[model samples]
Target: MTKSLQKSQSSPSLHPTRRFYWDTESLGVVGLFTALSKVVSLMVALLGGGMNPFTLFLKNGIATALLVVLVARVRKFGTLALYVLVGQIVSFLIAGGGMSMLLPSFLVAALASDALIAACGGYRRIGAVLAGVALYDLLGRAISLGYSFLHARENMAMVMVAGVFIVLGYLGCLVIGLPCGAKFVKELRHAGIIREV
Candidate 1:
């Protein structure tokens, strides 16, 4: 190759470390599931008359977890975890929270879930995803408890409710998230983001 061409080619298009962050292949599937989760959640919320946005929370959490799982299928869980964190923050703004004191507690939950799943080894089929959902609940409740203790906005009962909601959301996730994770991995493999085992 000509020296000019070689130089142009040699200049990296991205930081070598960052290539995994933008997994376009997985993003496609994540996009699809996001829409589905949102639609289903909205309908459920409108119909169930549940309190404290139970359906909406599950929908958003499951979507977030699925997106992150898709990322983890092809990239490091830590990198994907950051995406999850940023996504929650962005979703908060989009949902009308629009910035305020204290970053969303969901950010903390996402990191915790990602760490647990990473510890289990990135996307080992379905077991790893269950670990992720369970961790999401565990960490989310932890945050609610901390808030209850520090801010006194809620008492033990309220904190316990938060845990209950997390559990409820996770159960919903299990119904959807596990299959989605497997489908996400399958898509990434088909799209060549991850190699088939």
Candidate 2:
């Protein structure tokens, strides 16, 4: 066989390398998701008048799960964290920075999610994606509740009760979100909308 022919046959087709930082598509996807999440959150807040903390937690948990899944499928590493940070910033500004306590909680959750995803071998693994989402939900809620107890003078017992409900919400969100995310990613890939990582 000719060397050129052999070389051509042996070499696989070249594919574009994945960029680590935000590309135009990645930024667009993240921005859309973040904006959608914020809108949903605002709607939830408006509709949650006099609702118990449990219900609120559940709504937020589900939203977070969906956002995490979408972001994970599109962009890996710090992308989701960036989304969280941007989301929080926008939300804070919208609320006139009255939610100062939530900033740290969100930052911690975002960082932890990114680290956990990285540690579990990237976004390809369902376990990593789910775990990252679960942690993000759990820590975010827990920290927010803790802040309320300390600063808002909320009753510890009441907060604990709410925590139980929040935990259940997180579980339900994880159970539902993971499969849905997997299916969504599959569809996106099949449609050539998103290339597999």
Candidate 3:
């Protein structure tokens, strides 16, 4: 092959490092955020006194904000997948409930979110990042609601009530979470903790 052709083939622009691999930095970021998310969730659950509308909004909003920072810091395709996997594992280990029931929904949400972000121009674009995160939250909640409905088929009213609460939490994610996360990302960028990707 010609030298120019070979060089083009191996160009940094075409490299897969950012998209495919999980380096030390990537793993570290994911671990930090996952831990942070778990702590925040537990705190919210305890302090806010469980899944009331206010607590639902607060928990989901904070988690979504954290997720935005995670995606921004990682700037990779499978970052969400790794985040979800670790989160589920940790929750199951610590809380010991419904891991099997929820894992599939979370995994599907993360994968679909990653794919959507990639299709929309990867994590580099703020819009894509927000959209991906939004989709992840919405999809996960919807799937979980469906799962709950399946198990509680006799209590359609209860399921509907739960769905309303989920919707409230999702609205929080979109309205409160996304903006807080974007602001945090900007601050982190200015502080040089998160370089432009």
Candidate 4:
């Protein structure tokens, strides 16, 4: 009886008509995280200024950490892809045409990362969720570097410099973001905000 009670407590409220669909609760969670991610990104850029070492590390670290938490909280397929799409759309509206240039790379990375997570055992497994976030960061940066090279063909040296910063940003994600996100998840679980499975 206790086991059945626990199951009912943890299972999400599903859509009445669909076996696999994001219900209202899940969509609300995604929307909240998406807004938080963009607000954090914008604030970091304004406060840190440009792509210097401090800005690169701080921005990537916080953004990646937020993404990790978002995935854990949502625990569903396409979470990363939806997050990227919504975030980028907001960026395009606020930052203008310049933001659109990077959309392809971001979208592809999100899709691939989401697929890997789903294949590995879906979001219920913490390992898969972490791996997905890491892959999203790495692939997004790599693809953006390739795009940079193509557009700035005359300034190959600058592209290399950008590549160096990308590496640093990823290191920030690995060293700071991942751990911080995990800790935050633990805290959230403790606080009853993230129900355990």
How high is each candidate's TM-score?
0.56, 0.73, 0.84, 0.82
How high a TM-score does candidate 3 get? 0.84
List residue ranges in candidate 4 displaced over 4 A.
Answer: 1-20, 101-104
Cα misplacement distance, residue 61 of candidate 1 (Å) = 9.6
Global lDDT of model 3: 0.88
Choose the strongest candidate by lDDT. Answer: 3
- Residue 122 displacement in candidate 1 (angstroms): 3.5
Q: Report the candidate with higher TM-score, 2 versus 3.
A: 3
Residue 125 CA error for candidate 3 (Å)? Answer: 1.1
Rank by TM-score (best first):
3, 4, 2, 1
Better of 3 and 4 by lDDT: 3
Candidate 2 minimal-lDDT segment of 10 residues: 12-21
What is the C-alpha RMSD, rounded to one decimal, of candidate 4? 8.0
TM-score of 4: 0.82
Which model is ahead, 1 or 4, in terms of TM-score? 4
**lDDT for model 2, on a 0 to 1 scale?**
0.69
> In model 2, which residue pairs have backbone atoms overlapping below 3 Å?
none
Model 1 TM-score is 0.56
Q: Model 1, residue 190: displacement in angstroms?
A: 12
Q: Candidate 3, clashing residue pairs?
A: none
